[model samples]
Target: MEVNPLNIFFVKSDSKGDRLLFRYPYTTENKDESKQKKYGRHNPYAINSTEDLLQNPQSQTSNICKGQLSGFTDEMLSTLFAVKAELCNRKFELKVNDVRFVGHPTLLPYRTNKDDTATMILINIVFALQASASHSVVKCYYDLSKRLGKALRHEEKRCSYLTEEMKIMLAAHDEVSVLDSEMNGDNDDDDDNLRHSVSSATYSSENGADSSPKSAFHLILQRSSLARSMKSVFEELSSTGIVQVRINKWVLLSFCLPHKAHQIHNRGLIIEPETIDKCLQKLRPYHGILLMVNPNELLASIPLDSSSALLRLIKLYSPLKSLQTLAIEADLTLKQVSQLTGHLVYWAKATVIYPLCESNVYVVAPGANVHINSPLVEEFAKEFPGLCLLQ
Candidate 1:
């Protein structure tokens, strides 16, 4: 399954304080810049933004719970920064009102200025997932968050990217605050009451109302490079299990979501050297071959620069061509061809079988299930339209 995240938040904490620097699917009530005036200072949810209510379709279904998520995120700041030093650089998890937040919190050394040498800053990349998400799914997202955290740390150390971005975001917040104050004017009392009412109603509800005000403060992040990267990562990873994002023209981050395991293998299983030799002996260059599965996905999981040879080999592969024949056609050596086929089998991309021929004999295993009325009968008929199941 693809990784579907409700939201991805980048939280940073330093000597000053903790703040959410960026969040993906930068949400706001108003999609039009002209509507910016509609959102009063008391109601923080009002903003002029490019995106609609939510960009992610999967996340749109949870629109009703946006307020709960907002409140939970506010509460998460303290929880994320309050952890002991022992818990740093580890996965942090929290569940509230059916939403699960998984984050990797790491403390990295940051050079304060030209004068000061350096100091440690706590930063976390958090992924919001559904409560009923499977263990493997959660694990996949957690792994992604951990990788992102590490990448951010590396970039921060290299060129102070995180620090510069934070400064920009904070400046935006300050500017927005000033504008809000000017627009608010003498209506401060009325706005304060409205704000109080909104906050109180949002936190007290069961289904969770739209906690707009708190989220309004974060609208400044909509134009940030980090926010754009987060949106790209979420959309690409959710649609295809792989994503490549370039940050600040400094580093290119490529990640492939690990395949989910359906069944556990035997931990005690072992193969002796003689058994290995026998298997290798059976794998001969004279044997005809065909790919059991499509090689496109396997190719996508590898580096882009190294996929040309594999692509050529797969294009030339056929049941009629022996391994040696394929090597000659693909302009590769016999050893290289053999090793590629072995890698395919080891990675479950293909299966070694006797080449199909008129003289080849086929038999059913003793343990094979041959139930005539089973669902497999229909599936088999659909797969091979002219073939009889019994034959």
Candidate 2:
């Protein structure tokens, strides 16, 4: 006979926390699970954020309970008991003599050393005895966004390496949204860092409620007033735990596209090259060119002298080994940027993947050189900063 597939469910609760529900089928239910008395609270669905556990929980002192609420909802525990029940039939229970599944959960959010503070979680669930007795068991997990208490099971999601480019892309989209909201008179006091907001107070009473737990302050947050380019990519690096630029010394260079060159000329951020040098010095520790993907493009021109000056400054002060990827278009017809292009394509290990423009795609092997242009000028060079020599 075919077996029912075990399933898991996850729900993020209005940004404040998470609600994770789980269930699966088993050949035999454990004696231990049968003994678990129901929690008598009326709103059992109340989410428990990280703060709830770090601050308060009835079972806080218990090591087993602590283990269950770790960053991930001891997702493995469900599988362990399920697999055991399958193998041992009626005899399978947690804390059994021989556990069949010793391996870890396939999905883990936090790495070994990093601190994971994904707080405020919700897990709504129920279990019951099956009609037949091949020791058969059935479990269910429900999503809150779906029908009330109705189990909604899905195959576990598979995602990896939240890339630096992804971070920038997300930031860019969010920045535009925030800008639109600001224009539309959206209050500065809207949501927190992760876009979570708490609800207002309401009294409960059948016979005219008395005012108790009197409300004090209602706090809300506005979007941070920081430029996306200036939001400190280092903090982003810390959060994502992966880097944007992988610098290789010998291949480092800098160039401007076109319009930004006009911007520099008309509304220059710096009056003289010394001011520019100062800005570069401030960014020197980062060991890379300060860049925008579509800089000089669409503009008039950037004097070769500026590019020459920037290159000399980069070669001298910037971390020589920590430079690659220039964020400008190819405009200059001086020497062949082909060598730079070749190095970028082959050695730099860069593939020009489009996030939103995912319309047309071909899967290339990892560390593959994907060149979209011919031996001449690259067309979509802006999107593929992973390639193209400085203009």
Best by the TM-score measure: 1
- Residue ranges of candidate 2 with Cα displaced over 4 Å: 1-235, 238-367, 371-391
**1-391: candidate 1 lDDT, tens digit per residue:** 2235777777777788787666665555332232465552555676755766556544333422543244434435555544555777887887665667788788888777777488888878887777766675677677778887788788988888877777767765654444445444533687765755554463335224633333433544454677677778877765544567877666677764423211112122322324334565688877765565555665566655665777788877778778888889999998888777765654335555666677878787655456887676777799799885776
Tell me the number of clashing residue pairs for each predicted model: 0, 13
User: 165, model 1: CA deviation in Å?
Assistant: 1.7
Instruction: Locate the minimum summed-lDDT window of 10 residues in model 2.
Output: 213-222
Best by lDDT: 1
| TM-scores for the candidates | 0.57, 0.16
Candidate 2 residue-wise lDDT, 1-391, digit = tens: 1111112222112232222212221111232232233323456688865565556555432221211212123334433332311232122222222111111111122111225332221222221111221221111101111211111111111221212222333343344344334433465554632232211112112113532211110000011111121122222222321122211111112221111222322343212223333433333212332222223331122334444533432223221222322322233221223233222222112212222233546554554334444432354465566666333
